[model samples]
Target: MDSRRSPLGRAALLLVALVALPAAAQGKKPKEGAYVPAPADQIPGYSAKVMPCEIIEELIPPRVNCEGELLEGKSLRELAILRNTIFARYGWAGFRKPWLRDHFQKQPWFKPNPKFTYKLLSDADRKNVHFIGVREQSFTERELRRMEDTIFARAGKVWNDVYEWKLKDGRTVRSCAEPQDPLDEKEGCTGANCEGTHSRDCFFREEKWYRPDPKFSEDKLSAEDRIDLGLISRSLGSFASDTGKLEKGAQASLDRVISVQELRQLSLRDLRLLRNTLYARRGRPFKSKILQAHFKAMSWYRQDPNYTDARLTENDKRNIALIRSVEDEFGGPLKDEDWLIDPATDAA
Candidate 1:
């Protein structure tokens, strides 16, 4: 039998009810006012009031327009030049010296100012005078002639004015100055504080020996250091504030280091949760390198020491594999072997 009544049968019943029922009751509408939800008795079936559905366009927003940070032009060239120079001259250890040995040694009697300024000097007059050092000090030729000679010989025409002439009374005096232009009466072509046509070409080779700041200035690590370490990304800073263990509420602060995708894929509870396992196994925080580390750890664990513990399981491997697979799909950076695995232990 049909569950619904026929239209003709329903129409006849409706006509009869209309004729019998009161017009005042049928015409009245519910009052509009603020009130609590309908009581359980008042509603039929489910009592919970559900809002009507709203239609939203199925389209997703365009991907973010952020451009990845670009490296500096000059910085790249300078780094290449430095690398080439280092390769040519031993390694970084050999390149860094001089400043570490003797930082700022000055001749004791070097002159700060000359007794008389001369626009022009005869060959004999020029030979007699000398500038031993900064601060108006003078040094005897016998004291530092060998060292001065070595410098002049290496520089060639670059050290024409540099000389340590002998004085009367067995006291030797040295100019310790740079080679000056004989024709123009200008300072030496290349030496301390000497600037002229040829000065611009002179590189500050001596200054390179100064110890550079070990801490990263910008990216928290130089490109070379990152490359060498096989680190996909440099750490923002040391986790020093919390000391050995992460402080309470520090996990939220460290959220910036781990991306949302990483958090979703990995079952990490908090910052401290990854302390021993993550750091010891993975070393540095590389997006997907943890997978390889996990695999390596598993292989080792299947052996003697780890197998005896009986804590290793197939579930753990599955979870780690999922994390790695998702990380790969997301295209996050992975740490190189140098960063993810400790060389002393995992050299192979």
Candidate 2:
């Protein structure tokens, strides 16, 4: 292998190199640490009009790789598609889950091998499986943040960017650009304009999906909103203030107030979470596996060695005491369920 070689040595080296090329092309097993997926090839009569399996060995892909949809946006049915697609990428159990098999059977790249076992799963596979499973029971940081925004959005409350607007005359309108049809400028605005939005003409879209309420106020929020807002505030730190950060979360929780009406909206289990979230924010860990696992799932949760009840705000203390009183009426603290582990949180 020396670079300084005789002409005879060079010729012998060339012969050895020529001998190795054919073996590689002929599909000789590569040395250890070099593993390539079996080339996606046709299996005659294996599937009706096949293409390659779209699933590749990738990490817990962003949004778990569900097209354009974020992970939180993925419906349960969509999640099923992801799980089945993963399995189908490996050993597709033919005829068993025909609906599933038939779905990917048309992919020409899909090469099913019945010899599939847990041992064959790549790190990506294991992490994806666990991540997806855990997420099914809990919300990730992104989902939590979105849910925080959505709570206000559902109440017709608008922040800096209002896509739709409630016109003065009771006609719901848009804030108001992005016209669909170019022929007429009045198409989106209906020829009228709404207040201060970037788009002068506020046209009502056909669906009328997001009509902002002009009269939306904290006092007018539904009981459900009040409870949820409080719960989220307890988890997150605070609401939007003069600093121009996110303008979200519960004022009742922030202002040292918790109402019986809000408490009624939560279950005994949720009552426990609403209570513990205050502790969780200060880096306190939970003795219960349920609470520990649940809080650990949240990205914002940090275990603090110096965490103590004294770290809690006056509002936090008041909310905790109020929630605890309600829990007592229901026969004391609940045995937390890993079930219904969905919702979200943030302290500030």
Candidate 3:
């Protein structure tokens, strides 16, 4: 039927043609080998605002012309997704396409294309990109070594200056002191008559001087010089002798000894009795067993009775050697009473 012949027929034909136009367009597909640009919203699950500089910078990784001009924007996750998508679809050939290149260059949010290349990014940036599913080149051994050396050097510097002290009241403190101000005094100082003089006597109220324990010799400083520098802790020094002896399995050494505070509270007679008891118990297996049981009740006892010198763990042996070395400098065990006596009162 010729729909154009009459008014009614013509009106019906126009309606049919209008309905067929959309269906015909829908059936048409893109030609093979044609480059269809990915839609802006093609990347699913990513809706964050992307900066043009981030895209351009990632695209040109071999040069560094974009510094300072790149806007500091958010949505790093979305940018990463976009970067990977473009690279996967077009490779380096995508940048050669005028349309694709112009699309990024015309972004009004950033300046015109800043020249950059993949080589321009730092190792950290490379790692970040790789973490986002980009296959980046692995770091060479030399680069890895440089990073490791930097870490070790920083750690060594921190450890070399660190010092720890064990105080008379059974407290441990750590410090990082230089030779000029080894005691780390406050700027103005404290206590009575300390305003004018920055002397140790005026600043240190507890004793004429305090010394750090020998265990702190793990630093670069020599143990003897460190002790002479008044870094020794009284409580630690007092126990040092006995602790050193016990570690070496010395027959004369007791498995347990009284703390400085405990010894201070004892009467003269009690002190003598305790010493005699220790001397009598020396080298006696039954007494050793009894002492071991008593030591086990204390909070500080870590070794099991079954672990002897022959069966000592590597750590225990190392500790034994350290204590032995330090004890050799003292000539013998350093008892708590040696440092506890008030020399002023005794002299009178």
Compare the candidates by TM-score and give the number of the best one: 2
lDDT of every model, 2 decimals: 0.24, 0.46, 0.28
Per-residue lDDT tens digits for candidate 3, residues 108-181, read: 32222122122222233222332332111112223322332232232232222234434345444443222232
> Listing every candidate in turn, what is its Cα RMSD in Å to the true structure after a full C-alpha superposition?
34.7, 19.4, 33.3
Model 2 TM-score is 0.37
What is the C-alpha lDDT profile of model 1 across 1-348, one tens digit per residue?
000233344344334432442222245442353112223343222112211222111211111111221111112112223222211211112111122112111222111221111211222211111110000011122212233222222333133333333333433333454334222323332333334322211321233432323341323333333221211111111121211122223223332243334333221211212332333232333234333223232212222232321342444344345444443333321233212111101000
Residue 316 in candidate 1, Cα distance off native in Å: 8.2
List where candidate 1 sits over 4 angstroms from the true fold: 1-210, 214-304, 308-322, 327-348
* Candidate 3 local distance difference test against the native: 0.28
Candidate 1 vs candidate 3, lDDT winner: 3
List where candidate 2 sits over 4 angstroms from the true fold: 1-137, 148-252, 297-300, 337-348
Residue-level lDDT of model 2, residues 262-297, one tens digit each, is: 564344545677788777877897777657766775
Lowest-sum lDDT 10-residue window in model 1 = 130-139
